[model samples]
Target: MTFTEQLRQENDDVFQKIFTHPFVDGIGRGDVPKDSIIHYVKADFEYLNAFMKIYALSMVKAKSRDDIRFFFDQIGFVLNDEVHPHHNFCDYVGVEYEALQSSSLPPTADHYIKHMMHHAQTGTIAEIYAALLPCPWTYLEIGQELLKTYKPTKSHPFYEWITFYADEEVERITLELRHRLDQEAQDVSQEQKQLIKEAFRKSCELEWKFWEMAYICETWPSEQEASRI
Candidate 1:
């Protein structure tokens, strides 16, 4: 099997959990709570900021012009094309898009962003690809799988959000990333391949945790009596 295939196989358990998560299922069923989506959008907005930064760092580490352009184009896609989903969520729920810009990162999101940044900043191109693949890859898979089971009507609460990720462009982008990672793995040492594997798996786990974080609306505990620090 190819490297990308192996990565998917190894992480199938986590991907299954993400697919079956209440947040995802609710979106498919059009019954998700607005407050949960609000929390998810806020946290995910922060996550996307970190994601773009990692893409920039990957551009710096990229060995070929092709790889650099790949990252650059993806950054553009996120900045220009991906906002529709966030807007859909906010507009439906009566929240301003601007509010997401100022939202704080939930603890799980913070950890996941740090995880990707660590590899982007310090790892080889191969490892960086491995670390980053899970986001787009799994999201596209989620969208595709969800789409397979239910076709959202225009009036569905998450119609735009679901269709956005299920778009052909999203699938193309994911396949491109998978191809790039598989190509990068072709020349790496065995030890390097292991590092890539580990990064990929950890990222898969974080992907699942991100949904759980939103489902539960995670936050740091209040220190009510310590106001005057």
Candidate 2:
């Protein structure tokens, strides 16, 4: 079997555990109230705009032609055209692309972007995959689970949004990245391989943190409201 397949098989239990975690359950429940989720989704879009900018910059800084091309293809074709269109994720999330072009973002978001860029610039291609792969992979996995469990109806505001990202394109991309990571893994030194694993773990943790931040933002009540609820 390919390294990608081997890793997937080996990590099946780990992935299953993550899928069943309470935090993911909370998101899948869609119990947070539509307005709150919308607000958080908007914030997430703003966050994504910042993310894309850094990704673009990293593309420019990429040492290899393949890396540069891959970054551009991901951003231009997948993110911009495929994912963003379903919800106008930027507009719905209240982030004008032009404004994102002009302004700064939260420190945490900036730090995440910087970390990914650093990996791209200084690390091996496998290291870069380790850093970049988790975001989509997590989304794809969660999306599939959610779809199986949570059938969307008209009552759900972002059902389309959820469905779009969870669909075939993202799945294909995730598999492609996994293949690339596995192929590149053989070429990396032992220390670098360890670093790649560390980076993947850190990236997954960061992803959890990102969702946690959204949940926190959504759950926070105003002082007056807090007293009532």
Candidate 3:
């Protein structure tokens, strides 16, 4: 089996759970609360900022002009097309884009961003590819699968959100990342493969928490009033 296929099989539990998660399912049924989506948009913008930095690092660590070009193409998509829908949705929902820009990440969002940054800053090109594959890959998969049943009509509350991930370009990027991961995995030791799998698993778990955080409208908790004497 291909490395991507193997990774999917190994993490099937999380993969399936992510697809069935209410935040995702609610989008399918057009039942997602506006507040939930708004909070999620705020947190996700921060996630994308970190994602852009990692893409820059990926370009620096890339193996060839082709790889470099590929990274640039994907980065452009993220900055331009991928984030465009957020602006429209934010406006329609009465959320200010500036507020999203200035908003702080909830703890779960911060944790995921730090994890990606660690791999981008310190990992080998192979390892970085492994670490980053799950985000776009899994999101693209979710979009495609969701659309199989529910058409993302223009009237759907989260239509912009749904359409962006399901776009052909996004799928292409996801496939490119998977191909990069599989190619790099070809020469790595089993230990390296284990490391990649662990990173991917942690990322999937973080992704789940991200949606959960928004569903519950998470924010940093207040400090305790005082310690008991």
Candidate 4:
């Protein structure tokens, strides 16, 4: 099988675990309190907008052809679908663009965005891919699994939204990004491969943290507080 197919298989396996994960299942099914999920979504939206700004700036600063290409590919997707008419995250969260533009998010959210921007600006194109790949990869994996597991019925409020993100479009994007990464990997130095692995590992951790944060935000007490209780 091709490298892309292998990556897809790996991603699929990981996502199966994620979809059945108690935490993911809880949030996806709206078992979490409404207020908490709203808070998480709102905060995430604010962070997303800030992330977009930093991403744009980083792309501007990208010196190498590969770096510029990676930045533009991501920017195009965000602008064309994720942020605009095709799939407005703000709209999904019931927040107006103006509100998202004006609002401040949690420090953790800021840190995550900053980390991604820093990698994009200072790291190699491969490094940036290592950093940025987790979010969509994780989402797509969970989405595909959810598609299989969660039968869409009237009871599931966000079924359509969930399926949309995890469906064909997300799968296509995942394939595209993985292909780019594998191609870019060939050009990177051996030392950079280690760095990319470290960065990718960190990126994955951060992604896990992000989801945990969402779960915490969706629950009344923080995860720590919940644990203590």
TM-scores, in order shown? Answer: 0.95, 0.72, 0.91, 0.72
Off by over 4 Å in 2: 1-27, 33-39, 53-67, 82-108, 218-229
Give lDDT for model 3: 0.82
For residues 165-206, could you state the per-residue lDDT of candidate 1 as single tens digits? Answer: 998999999899899899999999999999999999999999
Which candidate number would show the highest lDDT if scored against the true structure? 1
The better-scoring model by lDDT among 1 and 2 is 1
Weakest 10 consecutive residues of candidate 4 by summed lDDT: 83-92
Which candidate number would show the highest TM-score if scored against the true structure? Answer: 1
Candidate 3 Cα outliers beyond 4 Å, as residue runs: 223-229
Q: What does each candidate score in C-alpha RMSD?
A: 2.1, 5.3, 2.8, 5.1
Candidate 2 matches the true fold with a TM-score of 0.72
- For model 1, what is the alpha-carbon lDDT of residue 98? 89
Residue 103 in candidate 2, Cα distance off native in Å: 7.5
Per-residue alpha-carbon lDDT of candidate 2 for residues 1-229, written as tens digits (9 for 90 to 100)? 8655655565565566657755556556654443334444545556565556645766655668886777777776544654453253344455554443433333444456667777867876677788887778888888788777887664554466567667898898788789878878888788877888777766676666655554454333354387797
Report the lDDT tens digits of candidate 4 across residue range 1-229. Answer: 7433544454454445556655567646646544445555666666666556655766665667876676666667666566432133344456555553444555566667878777877887667766677677887876666666676654565565567677787777676767777877877687987777666666565666665666566333365486897
Q: Which stretches of candidate 4 lie over 4 Å from their true place?
A: 1-23, 54-73, 83-101, 218-229
